[model samples]
Target: MRDLPDPGPWDEPEQAPPWRPEHGEKPRYRYWPQGHRPALQALVDGRWRTLQVHSRIDYPDGRVAYQGEIELPVEGRPAEHHHRAYWWPQPGRLRVAYGTDIAPT
Candidate 1:
């Protein structure tokens, strides 16, 4: 309707609720059974490394919301980066939702 304001980003329907974590499941690796290629990469210092990925959830048409980690050498010490990634074919592509370096648990 002409009276309706144009929808900005938040108009999409919400995704289904994610499953509850198992007891003591502090670190979980949820994943799809199949995905082609290592769909994302990051350049660290002077080198590149393929990220290790797993999905917390996915839709039937290949839309996935995932989390993963990468091992990086920071100032000669070992570190891990926790990241969230998403795959959406429409206006969105495979990309990092957000990420941060985290201490090992």
Candidate 2:
């Protein structure tokens, strides 16, 4: 198991305002609709590879982010690569704890 490191500072504010969450669990902003699978590019094994979006989380303050895991090659074998995935549709960039910024393909 390859555990990726924790993500760094988010490009946008991660926390929703106190009054926001009280309204409901639904995100105020909808960049990518729920159940939509978006493909993004990330740096894996020193090369850019396409990764599929597994799930998404929306903040009450209208912020949305995507996350998922990808299989990576390690020592000539495929290994589960877990990364702290955070997708910001506004910037059209995906940031992972693996030390690179992923972008929409």
Best candidate per TM-score, number?
Answer: 2
Highest lDDT model number: 2
lDDT of each: 0.40, 0.45
Worst 10 residues of 1 by lDDT: 7-16
User: What tens-digit string does per-residue lDDT give for candidate 2 at 1-105?
Assistant: 223243332232122223244466654332333345565655543455555555555665656665555554556567556443444652333333332233332
lDDT tens per residue, model 1, 1-105: 222222222223122233344322342435434442233444444354445554554544445444455554545557655343423332332344343343222
Model 1 error, position 16 (Å): 18
Model 2 bad stretches (over 4 Å):
1-36, 79-84, 89-105
lDDT for model 2 comes to 0.45
